[model samples]
Target: MDACSPVLVVGALLLVLLGASAPTVSAARAFFVFGDSLVDNGNNNYLMTTARADAPPYGIDFPTHMPTGRFSNGLNIPDIISTSPACLLSHLGEYLGAEPALPYLSPYMRGENLLVGANFASAGVGILNDTGVQFVNIIRIAQQLQNFQDYQRRLAAYIGEDAARERVSQSLVLITLGGNDFVNNYYLVPFSARSQQFEIHDYVPFIISEYKKVLARLYELGARRVIVTGTGMIGCVPAELALHSLDGSCAPDLTRAADLFNPQLERMLTELNGEVGHDDVFIAANTNRVSFDFMFNPQQYGFATAKIACCGQGPYNGIGLCTPASNVCANRDVYAYWDAFHPTERANRIIVANFMHGTTDHISPMNLSTILAMDNTRN
Candidate 1:
């Protein structure tokens, strides 16, 4: 918590990640994170799956210098957002206090911890129930929603139904799904079940339709202000580059899949908001475009390498998980990716900046700052 600490001093400059801050409005905020490996903090650690990060070199750059199942070399996207000054949660009123939401599966995450918020994300999950079946015990989107309902029941027991409803409505909710649908499902097995059932053109729409149900259910469960993120630049990740791009260029096929997914996601979110009679309720964060900025031009973003992951082996250093035997980068700040599929903590920080206050091009309709401003008025 030292302001003069190395990370803090650097954070001051990185705070410019979103360009500029919006008009200020202080209020109490509770943050809830739901997603795949991208936004998962430590939820997957408690699950039985190969899609985990609770091992050496995973959180090498974290403050604890130990793996926290974040799928990054340090703090992941959610952690950066929670600690950033541009985020309203960091400036929460003293009466509300501050604590990163606990993972829903954590045995220690109970009592007062539930009041702060809870993360229900499990690594390898997607919007579809069958998305990450290869990972065996991963929590699919429907199961996560069920857990959310369970959390609500526990919350109502502690603070009554009305208060819990208000807490959920007023609280900040972030959901980062869809990426796994591409990486782990449609493309996991060549001519996979999903791919054989429908081509890319039809598959994207199918995924969107299924995703619509999940968002509708979230709304039904009382998540008024939600930040739904699009999938990142899938083709640009080290895994794709290594497997499909021998020349270090992005795999065009996967990138096309992402292109197909994000725009429809935006339209679907807009339609959902309209159906609910609130324009700002479902905010879309264009993660694909934001990540493409850095992935396409790593040096421009201060990264020495974006194609080669800081860990793993074989081509692009992205063959598998980041273990002790993996080739570890001495300075993760210069790399865009941490492992085969996820970004380095520094890259995640930049993405979080865009989510905090980037314009419509980065975050559609409005950004997190605007959402916070609207919530401030109500709270």
Candidate 2:
């Protein structure tokens, strides 16, 4: 062939055009969830505990109009993040393939279902083993991690070892912890055991250290992309306000606990990412900042009220758990909270929007959209 043949030039041009026209095909990424009730789908249904939410008014807003062990009146955070077209609404859902990951304990999560990943989150569980001790039979973070390992083994049995490991390494992982550590443990009583063990100053670091270990374990288990959400405005929740607020304001002590916890959580995540030699491995979502937007200014976010629960009784509707006998709101969509501690599905969607496309202030290092774009490029 000639060094500068017209035929060769034409062929090169054609090759470039063909390459430009070909669409990129990225593999469907698996999703893994690990946390507490905020993301729990139906894991608690299989367990015997007071933490269970499989009851009336819990899933009244869900597609089936039936409770599915989710704390919210409708779909929880995880559901909105990974649900199918039927549940799709947020941009994040578009990235997360069809169908939400099934609860690890669900009977249907076997064989081919393993490839879709699983949710290991359990209601009332926290970073520490004793955080939700009162809710006996719940899966603690330690057990959740163990279950993740078991899940990999089960997946390996179906798709061989190396392939399963690769699938996990390329998957997206989300973990929301620490909140229950304070609410259900350190501040459960006037002088709880944890509160007495260490001052708020000291307790924050201890939990952050404990949480570091959990994140490290996830990374070790081949989780390359992980979203670590900080504690939200826990003090602003109806339950806290009812218990500790004197003038219908957020409890100062609990608010201080959250302020102290979230920043430290971000710092720990930053250190973890630096240790891994990658900036995008562990993205920290400032749940407090985004949540405060709707919690403080409900009307701005289209909510009628954030102080009262749609399904509770006492002050702020924050006294007890939402049950069949509670005063249910006429319009669940207008209420920021579904019960004493959980957010309504509408509130959850707003939170997810920030996670998917918020600034560095709301999502440190980079947002979920950036992570998705980068991962897609890599794939």
Candidate 3:
């Protein structure tokens, strides 16, 4: 019964050669990512936006020890979910033979690299086109979808049309949006245009309706299995604490926004699944609840503090951008927040761990490990 014994290996190969499906034998699955800085790897590096993270103290903890435009002290959520060995899901990473999807806009994403899939995420972008207008140049969701289409075309040119379609259909997609719509657009300034147009109660459904369209478009584009994450505890982030909290408490208004939005988001995903006639086409990751575990109880998660960001200045080190002059923590492992807005690599690992094996309360329908197992069996 040795796991890698000759008999098992030969049997697996024979099953594959005979076109017989086996749970243990499956083709390598491609991973496609689309969304904001939370999951952005380095797409912002190629853009001219102020949302860039290509500087010192940013990727000091990354393997290369060089900033890679990830809005974290080290790896971001997508990095851990896809290919990080340091994550608790490293076994799953090995099982999927996961590789970090290159930024779609990167010059290196050509030829055989296209077969590995691409990351279309950009910092500061949101579900709404106007969510991050302050950032001069960034890829909005519309453009990201268009880029995905272009990617598929290029892929078709390389591998034949039918194979390209198959690859995309079997891919795993991750989309993280909505947070910016609140923080950067609606509540960015007093009497902000979005806020002026719609009250908080009205805005949530507006964005959710728009989000459904985006998800539908994704399905139309051949994305069968997508992991859609709700906004994190936005009110508890260091930035909101600095701006709104007077005595080190989560901001009430922004927290209220998250409360209103996340449930609706989950409902929308459920309805979308029903429309697709399957229970597992879209899996909603309850990021707010998972993040609350560490943000409210940093000690339980081996963190010294969650309110104080590892990089930044002013109250909670949550004011201003994480520039070279800003205070930087010597050990990123003990802090929960990286900057005012992003999470440390360690925190990202915890969030992704839930995505892999958490219960329905955290990941609805089924977790990623379950989805992978089912998909592998089906294939």
Candidate 4:
């Protein structure tokens, strides 16, 4: 594929209402996405957390304009993944596994449904275990990885090893998480009171270790192709900087934590590939640099408001919940965030653009499309 060629993946030229201009992704198959609020469609109804999207103004710009349990004004990451024809199987992590009914897969996916993936990204999920204590009950990355394990086992039984391996190998697994780990552990939980008590160095290794566990579990389950997205610019989030430390400068403390965390994340990825005895174990999605570049110089990116979110009031001030009266914005595309904590659709698109390049983050060394292209070889 030519780097300079048109980035469009599929021509999904099908009109919305008999005749309409539309952008389409290239043809591919299978998308298994995991992460926090960014990718979750509606899997948290089983939990007991106030941090939820099963409410209004969350999916106002989406097809049904319904909340759908996503933590944004419109399409979150999972929607973006399925919209592309290149996707085959889209799966998310839902709690209670079998105790609760599996969430409904979306209905609009064309020409085969593209296997809409359900989200396992619980709102306050983080790399560490204790991040969502206040929520009473929530889905963490480790638990989600365990669910993947169960899904893989079931697939193995039904399809047999060789065929199962082939399918999983040809598949694309997108894992986007870690922000709440920083926020909840470093600032929200007991850590806030223990501010000077702990250092970034202290927490970095533990989280990296947990991340490795998740990767190893995925590989053991049948994942031959993986796309691990780095936590986007956290300190730049309206939730973080607005209320806690609004000095207009990025939080060196938190930024330093990410800096420490990312390299370790990359090193572990490199190590995972090594353990898998191949260079294709995963793609590192360098989201941190992409976001930092835009944040430090918003003027260069044509975004006038970088530090503040168009959504709320107070410190990093994504400090409050997004109720109907929260004063939603008209053009989420122009703003960096829909609410204080989440990125707007436009920012997500740009991030996806960089992810499509395959080098923007440590999660994918090659874009997910390229990884799926490899699946063609195995097929």
Best candidate (score: lDDT): 3
Off by over 4 Å in 1: 1-27, 84-97
For model 3, which pairs clash? none
Error of 1 at 126 (Å): 0.8
Q: lDDT by residue for model 4 over 92-136, one digit each (tens)?
A: 111111111123222332222222223456777777677766776
* Tens digits of per-residue lDDT for model 2, 1-379: 7633445434432432233221111246788999999999999999999998999988897766778899998878887777443223242257576456788998877765677788999999998899998998899999999999999999999889999999999898999998999999998888999999999999999999999999999999999989999988999999988888777688888789999999899889889999999988999999999768877788998999988889999899999889999999999889889999999998998888888899998997988888889887878
Task: Indicate the TM-score of model 4.
Answer: 0.79
Give the TM-score of each candidate.
0.90, 0.91, 0.91, 0.79
* RMSD of candidates 1 onward, in order: 6.2, 11.1, 7.1, 7.9
- The local lDDT score (0 to 100) that residue 273 gets in candidate 4 is 95
What local lDDT score does residue 183 receive in model 1, on the 0 to 100 scale?
Answer: 89
Model 3 segments beyond 4 Å from truth? 1-26, 84-95
lDDT against the true structure, per candidate, is 0.81, 0.85, 0.86, 0.63
